[model samples]
Target: MTSRRLFLSTILAGLTVPALARAALSGAQQAAVDRVTDWMKGLKTLSATFVQIAPSGALTTGRLWIQRPGEMRMQYDPPANILLVTTDWRLVFYDGTTKQVNYIPVAQTPLGFLLARNPDFGDEVLIRDVEVTGGEIRITAFSKGNEDQGSVQLVFAEKPVELRRWTVFDPGGTKTVVTLSDVRTNQDIDQELFVWRDPQLFGYPDLD
Candidate 1:
């Protein structure tokens, strides 16, 4: 796979864990997880400008729009020529340069948990580690039986409990970090942003 495709699969496809034994959580860890879960459940909508550092150390900027229960759009800045959208049940990846489109189940992505109407961290996800430091909370997790696929570390600010960024580590140990800026939450986003129209058939429209 190309580096761009690799990064997308690592972030949105490889992290699915179908069935596995649950890991034990300490009292403090469980409390932290509860707080994170609550924050996720309350997040109805979000819009942000993001800076993504790929595994190759290449940097790209984009705008992100997300609505809960399963919808997201990531429109990369020009020269990157990539777009990713999550439909009701699938994650759609579009390669603007090649006009290629790919689809994968939404539940198979690490972001699925965040998009789930009721995010559950118990059986579907494994909490490998949790760190609280410098007024930040970081949760590192992966699929229980699918740890070889990769893991995602979600970073959040403490005082206000807002998501700031996430690092996705591929199987080879390379990591892609995406940091969010100018984040606005609980704001209305245009529903059209999440629509997945075939770029090849319908031609690409300005979804930005």
Candidate 2:
């Protein structure tokens, strides 16, 4: 089954940044966006684990691979049978149970719109507030009308913008927390891995 961690991690992790330091980040919200942007600007590729969790307690984990200027692929673990991939112009999902590979033009997805029109990390999703405690940067994003149209909280590492964790809360109160670990950037990735293929033909379309 999918680990529940990977699904939301990949999308929510892309929460844009906020306005210029009006005052300064005494805590997380201010520092995180700047730190993450600084770090990402120096790299070319990013890979990590992503997750999504349902309130019922199911979990899904996927390999989160990202290529700069907009490219990513998240392949869920066994049994869950779901894959979310971005091939520049498309954001595709293959559902095993449905035996259908559903794809939407990147222009249509809320997340896609964020990446396509604002990949620079500027103009954050809009920060509702920021607080610092102990050693974490805790930032809450704007309301539903914000960039990604969701409310979220991001926790930044003490060192910099390397996001340690984040949570996305939908209008209905459903929440997904994503924890990022073993982050590596500038690694070479094979181009073939991002392409979409038929699960029926591959026998494990879910894995493909």
Candidate 3:
């Protein structure tokens, strides 16, 4: 059985950031970061279909539901048998294959800053690089005081300022790229989507 801790550790171990000889965010870069932060904080709810490519190139498809200020659910497709959710203070992982649930303190995960009440580009997260290419804004950052935890790169489409995809690089230099499609924002998402239930009891059906 693959516990959540083991899974997370496998992807998030031995990560380090190389110091870059760069100055503070330029005026344009700062504006772009602020635009993204402002857009992110204004999002109350978001739902989308996602394709996640793991470091080893394994792919998983899922539906993602997010409610800001600390709530989210990533429900994987068949054969994956995984559900990752976040609450105010914890990150929960449900394994449908083994009917086991794992919990980790939110503060220990990069998700903590992402789901914060006011996710900004400073302090909690240090914006490392910002670029604009083909009408898309790419912002990369690492958790402050814990750069070894890994890094997050967020890509947004401009004109409408929509989040298109994000890539997470774990400590071992393994990258997980998630691309979003069919996104619906600020919609009324059901509270139950964020709730954790025993898959064997009434949720996901087990694979025989």
Among the numbered candidates, top TM-score falls to 1
The sequence of per-residue lDDT tens digits that candidate 3 reaches over residues 60-141 is 7888888987898888887877887787568787877677877877656655565678787665566778998899999877
Q: Considering summed lDDT, which 10 consecutive residues are worst modelled in model 3?
A: 14-23
Instruction: Candidate 3: list runs displaced more than 4 Å.
Output: 1-23, 204-208
Q: What would the per-residue lDDT of candidate 2 be over residues 1-208, giving only the tens digit for each residue?
A: 3433444333433333233322344555555566655655665676777665655566767677767656777777777777777885787777666666656665443344223434443243455567666777666654223343445676766665455666766545566666767787788877766776666686433322
**Ranking under TM-score, best-scoring first?**
1, 3, 2
lDDT of each: 0.79, 0.58, 0.73
- Assess candidate 1 and give its TM-score to the true structure: 0.89
Model 1, 161-204: lDDT tens per residue? 88999888777677889999999999888888888877567765
Tell me the TM-score of each prediction against the true structure.
0.89, 0.70, 0.86
lDDT at position 186, candidate 1: 99
In TM-score terms, candidate 2 sits at 0.70
Q: Quote the positional error of residue 46 for candidate 3 in Å.
A: 0.4
- Winning model by lDDT: 1
